[model samples]
Target: MDPLLLQVLAAKQIPSIGDDAMLLQESMVELINSNPKAGWKAALPSRFSNYTIGQFKYMLGMKKIPKDASLSFPVGSHVANSNLPAQFDARTAWPQCSSIGRILDQGHCGSCWAFGAVECLTDRFCIQLDVTISLSVNDILSCCGSSCGDGCKGGWLINAWQYFVQNGVVTEECDPYFDPVGCRHPGCTEVWQTPQCVQKCKSENQVWSDQKHFGVSAFNIQSDPQSIMAEIYTNGPVEAGFAIYQDFPLYESGVYKHVSGKLIGHHAVKLIGWGTTEEGEDYWLAANSWNSGWGDNGFFKIKRGTNECEFEENVVAGMPSPKNLNSALSGGRE
Candidate 1:
């Protein structure tokens, strides 16, 4: 065991044998459970234990850019209120939209950037238009080209939203996700190639252009807690990009805060709602693309209000075009 590794584990209160503190060695799980201050539960998830910290970090693929002046949206009075609930979950709020609760895996790619955007957009279509449709994440990942970023390797959220307005994306039923079961099993590495862009639909009956859905506008929200709550409360869910630390993958339950481990990488997830714990810690309920096997059944509660991991700073979303929806409902393509 390296002396520095021991020091880090002690400082983080995670019992370890001089390895990456975030790596789920068997000893760390017992140490994690005994340490009350650690706040979250740790498990040697057999799926996660298969890879080293470096390999696991490669699984994250959200590449963020500076906030554009033209892209920010004002927190409208539609959702503004002083009496916001202490806890709110989008799944509970919009039970009619099954997509709100559905979790998808990004697989062996760093396509979380695309997953976060489409997941939120899929929920928003149901929430805003009273129309239930699962948007295709693959459409953005494979086809958006250099404008969206290098597909699979990573992507830009704003560019994705813009692509929705400019080029549009097909339904999940048309294209579907590329690698649904790739990254979950043991021995998986950074081998997910950027899927080739295909303009055609998978189904014989669905025309690629007719299956396309569009966004009205792309924009960012105010980073304040109330503003974020108002956005999710009014608009369903929003995509949030944040700095991920090593202790993140070990998160099983409780309001997560950076406890131990090095800065791994930046990743994105969908912020579905907000809440406070029984212990009175405030948190944002988020859905990850790492599949349900990881953390609280594919969801996580992270420290809110304080902008832990800068989660609040990079929130972005857009509205589904009602014209496109109306056209689709009327059996026409706009």
Candidate 2:
């Protein structure tokens, strides 16, 4: 690895504010600018050749990429409506979300579906149940079965929620799992203990109730994504979708100027809040699990309103409130 790249990675391991981290990231970018090929050689090896400097920098904190890195789609495919209410301004809405807490990213795995499902589950779980519990993505990743393939390839978020409904999830600790190796073990420490439903909900002609122990709803965004994002931030963390730019330029600080790049895949990230830059451009505050080093201490902002970074408008899945129960069946979207 290039000595300078190694230094940047080392500095990231320590906890720091997003602004400071951005500053260091800029310094690293400058180092690479001076020697492009050498820097690419050091920061991006074969395993990382598919990623740009920014993408590779983000991956340094993760153990490995999930299997579906090449299969993600951009958010532009599902924009439905665009009429905005008077109060909805990207500039203000972005900062509001950022102020609340740090955002998170889910890296290259299709486990994004898992993270997305769980984040909304956790947030709503806290609000509805009055309990602050970090539901286990590890449990879903480990036990949802072979039908969903291995964690790396990809799985539907709805399927994960269905698994949770029937099999009442255990704490993440009991499972201690990760993606690309979905549920490698059998026999959970705590068995899902609940009554079986004699009859399922018929709303969607599906055997499972629309009111399964946990349920998620999908929606389409027509206008400014920031408006919907504001709703999610106020309500709690939401599972928002985005296109992964493999070639996002790596800079230590300042606003991210757009560049053409490959659309590697789609990902689910936790929407903590929104914020704006000194110049008043809008952005959504996101959290990434790639570790604390990547993007503003495991967090970063996506441009709002450009249609490039629109998230909430493309509602992939909205988890319904979970009931206290045990064991649900697993299958793809109906």
Candidate 3:
């Protein structure tokens, strides 16, 4: 084994595996050795270099999805004008860049659905209201009812957005991640938990009168590149779910596709924009909740329109309400 690869294994505390680990190692080595001309580059050795395929899948967060497949098509309010840019990047799109500098971590919990929804919700609300209230992921995870799945045990993005629009989500100051008590607290390295959902506000004090910030509407986008782009370009950052493959974790930069590694599970992410690479490969720029240490400084670009990893299959977006009081959103024309 390469010394650096061995070092990464030790650093990540990769568990010893039987034949399965060996097989995964060989597959990774083969991909590295072959060096296909794929647009993205995989790591020669990274945190996941020594992990078994099963181990890789375990690290992936997403699982079940909602059975309901209906999406509000023609997305009445978000029809982009002829002036829509062929290429757009929400991260730098002037006032539309509500999600910039706000990358979040789901900790060790499988709360990607919550994180993705709230982060995008926060951005959408901020863009619509010009406010900076950080929405609570914990609230959605704990209070979204039985159908939204168990807290930190994984859930559906559709249910998450639906909950946000209907019930509203409180600020981070209200719920504050995992509360350090739930076994699901990602920072609780020694203890893993299913987490009991309990809503808290300001050290148990009522700094504000309300329990949540809210939006007037939320909807799923058509499973196509054009609709995905129009939704984000018109609304703000949108939430999406994609299948996670073994090769996904090692992504360093550039447009990503399944170059190696087997499929693990699904993952939720925030879709910010779309652009064609200099190589003419179309890609979707998204923000992941795995922290800045993960990929492309906490963000990633994936092959677009190809339904790579089943990404475009389940795109969702929502509209934030005007100011805490009431103001009007221009592009979000309702």
Better of 1 and 3 by TM-score: 1
**Candidate number achieving the greatest TM-score relative to the actual structure:** 1
Q: Residue-pair clashes per candidate, as listed? A: 0, 42, 1
Q: What is the TM-score of each candidate against the true structure?
A: 0.88, 0.53, 0.79
When summed lDDT is taken over every stretch of 10 residues in candidate 1, the lowest stretch is 14-23
Error of 1 at 215 (Å): 0.6
- The TM-score ranking, best first, is 1, 3, 2
Model 2: per-residue Cα lDDT at residue 312 = 38
Local error of candidate 2 at 71, Å?
A: 20
Q: What digit string (tens of lDDT, one per residue) describes model 3 on residues 75-117?
A: 4244545766868877677454445556776655678888888
After superposing candidate 1 on the true structure, give the runs of residues whose Cα lies further than 4 Å from its correct spot.
1-22, 27-31, 67-80, 185-188, 326-334
Clashes of 1: 0
Rank order (by lDDT, best first): 1, 3, 2
lDDT of 1 at 250: 78
Tens digit of per-residue lDDT, candidate 1, span 1-334: 3435544775676433332334565555565566677678877665576666666777778787755643454333235678889889999999999998998888878888999999998899899988888889889999998988888778877788889889888888788887767576554566658878887778666677877788888887777888888888888899999998666887888888776656778898999999888888899999998888889998999999998999988888888886556545543432
Q: Give per-residue CA lDDT, model 2, range 1-334, as digits (tens).
A: 5546644653554333331123123334444444423212112222232333433333221112233641342221233334433233322444433322433334343466667666666565555444444455555655565533345445554455556555545433333333323222242111212112233232333333322345433332224665455445344555566565433323223333333233334555666555566667766666655445544555556666665533534443344444543222232115
- Kindly provide the TM-score of model 2 when superposed on the true structure, using C-alpha atoms: 0.53
